[model samples]
Target: MTTEKLVSEIRKKHSFLCVGLDVDLDKIPSFLLNEEDPIFSFNKAIIDATHQFAVAYKPNTAFYEAYGIQGWKSLEKTIKYLNENYPEVFTIADAKRGDIGNTSSRYAKAFFEDLGFDSVTVAPYMGKDSVEPFLNFKDKHTILLALTSNEGAFDFQTKKVEDDEVYKHVLKTSKNWKNSENLMYVIGATKAEYLAEVRNIVPKSFLLVPGVGAQGGSLTEVCKYGMAENIGLLINSSRGIIYASQEANFAEVAAKQAEKMQLEMKTILDGIH
Candidate 1:
């Protein structure tokens, strides 16, 4: 999907919510375990239930990788289902894959062409050579890790290299990359305070924000600082929404959780208008 189409979905749905499909079999309802492909079955239910309230869905690669080949198949099925049924909803492969130039090209193909994801989370630590390959695919986005929500982010991301923080340099330097317009960023909701500085670097770039709900990051604070004119934030909630219940009504409960966030997002969007 194009960036404009993504924004259109947000406007149509009154949401910028990205439901994280970081499904763990152990955490899912016991009943689903009996299904032939439990991971895909669980994902289908959640997608059906929550698609209306979400503009995007992100499946972290680790969850599926844990189950080996079967897990990879489930991930494939999940994306295929979304592509055929809910094409309007943006799909993200939350696979933080990055390496040397040639290797990164294959990674891009795996997610963008083979798996059919609209975007993929990429680690920019390897520099432009590693990231430019992903940007070569038109309409596909490479969401670079900027400032993350994890506590460990303090170790290197925030350190001052010269006069500015390391992440600031990332934002500034990445803007000049080939096809930089296709670049989005991952800024954790917990680091809302640094948003103004980030915006100054790339005023209209979209942000894939994790660390809401379960991580105790305030939605209000994130929007207060991070929101752009085009509503460039995809706030993710995984455990808090998808695992709201492990009973038969799990999908319905997940929808309710999504609705709660969408309603809050509606209020924020209304305020913006």
Candidate 2:
């Protein structure tokens, strides 16, 4: 999806909510386990329930990968369902895959072409060559991991690499890559204070922010510091929304949670729109 399309969706819905489909069998309702593809079953319901309030759906690949071959099938079906049913809503394969240049090319093709995700998350630790391949895909986004929500992020991301933090250099150096325009970033809402510096570097790029709901990140603080003029923030809430209920009406309950966030986002967007 083009950046313009994503922005347009956000404006139309008065929301920039990206519901993270981080499904866990251990946590999902017991009854769903009887279904042939429980993962896809759960995802389809969530997408149906939350599409009105969400502009994007992100399925963290780990959730599917854990189920092995069946898991892979579930992921494929889930993406297909989203593309066919909710074409307007953005899809993200939160795969976090990055490797050598050639390997990265295959990864790009797998997610962008075969599976048809609008975007995929990539780790930038291997540097420019590893990431440029994904950037080569026009309109498909490469969301590079920046300041993350985990405590271990302090171990590397915030450390001084000479005069600046490592993530600052990641943001700065990445701008000169091949199709840098395709780059978006993953900034953790838990580290909202660092967003000011992040914006200073990539003022106009979209940020896929996690840690807002389940992880206790402040949505208000993230918007205050990181929001672009176009409202370039996809605030993700995984467990807080999808796992809101474990009963027969799970999807209905999930919709309510998503709408709650959407209403909050609507109020924020109202200020500038």
Q: Return the TM-score for each candidate structure.
A: 0.99, 0.99
lDDT of 2 by residue, 1-273 (tens): 899999999999999999999989988888999998889899999999899999999999998889899999999999999999999999999999999999999999999999999999999999999999999998999999988998999999999897899999899999999999999999999989889999999999999999997888988899999999988899999999999999999999999999999999999888766
lDDT for each of the candidates? 0.94, 0.94
lDDT of 1 by residue, 1-273 (tens): 899999999999999999999999899999999899999999999999999999999999999999999999999999999999999999999999999999999999999999999999999899999999999999999999999999999999999988889999999999999999999999988878888788889889999999988887899988988899898899999998999999999999999999999999999999989
The clash numbers for all candidates, in the given order, read 0, 0
Q: Give the CA lDDT, 0 to 100, for residue 86 in model 1.
A: 99
